[model samples]
Target chain A: EAAVTQSPRNKVAVTGGKVTLSCNQTNNHNNMYWYRQDTGHGLRLIHYSYGAGSTEKGDIPDGYKASRPSQENFSLILELATPSQTSVYFCASGDVGGRAEQFFGPGTRLTVL
Target chain B: EQQVQQSPASLVLQEAENAELQCSFSIFTNQVQWFYQRPGGRLVSLLYNPSGTKQSGRLTSTTVIKERRSSLHISSSQITDSGTYLCAMGRNSNNRIFFGDGTQLVVKP
Candidate 1:
């Protein structure tokens, strides 16, 4: 089975703090994505990377940045966390094309106070 | 705008009964997938049926590319099957996939 693991399964940070969520996939998939899920909005794409050193903004990219330093790792960074950023975040990896299935990590729950 | 839409935002089923979920896309797409997420759990891919019909275990998924719609049929639903089912649509040109709000299912014994 494809494996995607995320660090700090749960986190709590104060407002204006910096938070970094990391994701690693052993599937070696070429595409990785970051998404945040909320009650009303469902899952909105925050950022995605085609490969190492490449990142693209998704539908909701404000107050968020992404880094893909290697094929196995992708990270979502919130330079200034806010109470509104408190949500469950998911990371997924997939094949080069959009036709393939995406494998999602366990998820990270962020709480900003 | 929500490009992907799922019907019956929520559902309640008795054990051993069957459940049917529907998904529709506003834009043309050849990439359609079904995902499942348990309460307070991660998302898992259930089916990747771009077109035609496909089955795995007690789950069946049918996609009609021309109609721009898909359906997931869960036979003999169990309590373990209770979860939020999400449908995602992708385009051939880009790697981005759009997601629906999801259909939350609850199974009662």
Candidate 2:
């Protein structure tokens, strides 16, 4: 089975602090995605990358940014964290097209105070 | 525009029972995928039925493209099945999948 691993499984940050969550996927899938999970809202897509050095906005990308420095890694950066950003973050990888199923990472739980 | 939507925001069931979750999409989605997530855990792909019907183990999924809707049926529900079932749909041009809020299922022994 393909494995997607995320670092900083748990993080606590003060408001206005900068935070970065990292994800690494061994599947070598061409598509990667970042999402945040909140109560009642389900999982909202924050950003996605088609490949290395490419990033695109998703439905809720206003408070977040993404970086894909390499094909195996993707990072989510919060310039200035806020309490509203306290949520679980997930990383996923998929095939070249959307038709394929995505493999997800263990996820990171972030708390902004 | 919020293209995809799911029904039964939550569900409670007993062991050995049956459960059905529904999902609807406003846009003309070419593919539909269903995922299951345990509390505080990552999502696992349960089914990826673009259209028609497919079955795996005790889980079955059916998608009606013309109707722009899909359904996931769980047979002999187990306590381990308690979690959230999320439905996502993807179109031809946009490989990004639009997700529904999901249906939280709680199974009691």
Two-chain DockQ for each candidate model = 0.70, 0.62
Per-residue alpha-carbon lDDT of candidate 1 for residues A52-76, written as tens digits (9 for 90 to 100): 9999999899999999999999999
Clashes by residue pair, model 2: none
- Candidate 2: how large is its RMSD? 1.4
Q: Candidate 2: misplaced stretches above 4 Å?
A: A98-100
Candidate 2 local accuracy as lDDT?
0.90
Residue range with the least summed lDDT across 10 consecutive positions in model 2 chain A = A94-103
| lDDT tens digits, residue span A10-104, model 2 | 99999999999999999888889999999877788899999999999998999898999999999999999999999999999987655656778
Which RMSD values do the candidates have, in order? Answer: 1.0, 1.4
Give every candidate's TM-score on chain A. Answer: 0.96, 0.96
Q: TM-score per candidate, in order?
A: 0.97, 0.94
Per-residue CA lDDT of model 2 for B1-109, tens digit only, reads 7688898989999999999999999977768899999889989988889999999999999998889999999999999999999999876665777789889999999
Docking class of 2: medium
